[model samples]
Target: MSQTPLQEIELYAFASNSAQFHLTPHEFDVDLGGTVYVSTPIERNELALGAEAAKSALELKLPQTCDLVRHLLANALTGDTTAITLRIARRDPWGDTWWIAGTRWMGRVLGVEVADDGARVRCESAQVSLKRIGLRRLYSRTCSHVLYSAACGASPISASAIVSGSTGRSVDLDGGVPGSVSGGLAGGWLQTPEGARHMIVSETGSGVELLYPATIEPGTEVLLTAGCDHSTATCASRFGNLDNYGGFPAIPSKNPFSTGVF
Candidate 1:
């Protein structure tokens, strides 16, 4: 296969918190024909949010910082690299939870390394504290994209079973193999041998269900892709919010029960 354009650049970051916040990015300049090197100046940011605020407020500041660094790297790098590494250097004296004085969060970029042909791209690590609540959610989104890029050749897994509406039944993949059983997105679920994995669609009740051949152990890395057809339909329907006027009951009176509380 032809090499991707972004197969050489590396990105890393370092962060510090001290009544102030700091973030720095180190770029790796590489000669595709040669080795990569860098000596970029570290970037920094300092801001203050009242100590009494909710942790969520503090958490919100992270994405903008991360985006800034991403944009910087995107502009700095010539093409997409095989892999980029980011390290968030954080120190919370009062713990990852308590945002007291001297509480600090630091971020820094280490650099990037190229992968060999046919080798998977390296996954970036975001070190977060156990006390940090929203970090996991952010990490999931970030890591998912990396995994998708690195595992491009993997096939989708066919679910072992399916549960839709009120009915549950066995499902068979037509000529599908074991590794082909990739997970489905939003409305799609994977069928395991143990039970069915269900994806929630909306508040009302619309989603996909997957029944697997066996119980999926915790921490098992299951690859799931959005079901193209189902996802398209769901999106086209605007998340199941399409108007079904025909199903609406006709009003018996212009003002039912003479009260406007219908």
Candidate 2:
């Protein structure tokens, strides 16, 4: 019997917040020739110590798009390399698989080199240690599901939810009804036409402030969806999404203190 030929290879790029990029095939490539490091000490001849951790690097050719550049720049500015998780997948005639060589390298863009022709951007990234991912809750969340990325099975949000606004760090939305949003939409985001979403820092009567100073073209149309603050009341009353709430609201805030030490 003939073996199934490898048909397709794909690379998945994610932003610092796990927001996936719907990039086309032409935008990137996955190099399978990268090295995987395992720290084994050489003591006796052909004898070695236990493995410490694995290290891998990925090189990507990202197209020069407005949204992609912003996402990369945000990583550069914040020194946040923990959020990126590159999953290389391979597809044979009958099956599809991931983690190309049995590992998922999660890391940030260490350096980005722009082509002189200004047509493409290239980046190099190193894998982050597994310990950090656990401590920061970067991948494995204690919550039930990932926010925004999970399948909520809800109907599509209407285009009417797309609010027009003046471009700036703080956008003033036109016809924004006061109290329309419950508990304010802090930690939410405003999405650009190019699929870039900036987190909302605060919401006022006129507008909302973005967590970063994003590039806003004049007369740019941005979309915003109200977000809950993850409080039990907000999840239950405001969104009726208590079942999906990621916080442990019932957990006691104060530690048990005794009047005297034993």
Candidate 3:
């Protein structure tokens, strides 16, 4: 069977020769070598400038006796390494555009391209493991799940989970064989006889967070299967309720943008 298209992907960029540039997804730019001239959107320019200023400030605050120039150069080299690693992590089953500096992961992929014209990601298989630290707040709010496939190549992964708090919600899984409560008030890891795992949180007003395991290396492709009840009260109110009957709603099988194929 052919693979489904990817819905979302992460990109990383490494500065080669102090290259100055901007990236999609976040739409932020950076000056690779030193400050140069460029034209960019006001918002993007501000964000980029802020990042550069922050880095410069850190460089200045280092030990006074330290060789600041050497330190700065070393840091820039380190940053390039990080960027390349990130870029490599974004590889899918298809061709990828990333520059590997060393064994360390750095670099950023700028855009995403799908195999099919407009298909969205549909997870086929995945390997899940528990994390030492649970999911973080941003992951819960932005990407609650990840979906992958074979045909997509080594350039992209799908949706990252976002945090969404529940409101007086509960559900009985497998027709009441297992019951779960929402509202960020459910805690503990719930395991099924069939071998699926779930980490439950019971703190009031907290959203469930998802963490992408470090084992999910670059160039590996796996599909994601998200439960239908993956919406917060706020999200449901803003975007129509995603629940279909008693089951979690299926994620759209289409990309949100037409340019997703790239």
Among these predictions, the greatest TM-score belongs to 2
Q: TM-scores for all candidates?
A: 0.18, 0.44, 0.17
**Model 2 global lDDT (CA atoms, 0 to 1):** 0.47
lDDT of each structure?
0.29, 0.47, 0.26
Off by over 4 Å in 1: 1-39, 49-129, 134-262
lDDT of each residue in 1-262, candidate 3, tens digit only: 9896543332333343444332323233323244321222211111123323222211011121222222223232123211222221232356532222322122222221122222111111011112225643223332233111121111121122222222222222221112133332232222223323233333222233221111122222222222322344423442243332222345555665964864
| Global CA lDDT computed for model 1 | 0.29
Comparing candidate 2 with candidate 3, which one achieves the higher lDDT? 2
Compute the lDDT of residue 87 as modeled in candidate 2: 50
lDDT per residue (tens digit) for residues 100-202 in model 2: 5333444555554444322233323343444344554322223333334343221212122334455556677665524555245675566678766566668
Native-to-model Cα distance after best TM-score fit, residue 174 in candidate 3, in Å:
10
For candidate 1, write residues 1-262 as lDDT tens digits: 9873332222232322211122333343422223222334433233344532112111111221233333323222222332222222333344432111222333223232212211111222233233546633222211122211222222333333232223232222322223332333433344334332332121112323332112334333333333322222332343242231112233344655587765
Candidate 3 ranges beyond 4 A from true positions? 1-85, 88-169, 173-186, 203-262
Poorest stretch of ten by lDDT in candidate 1? 53-62
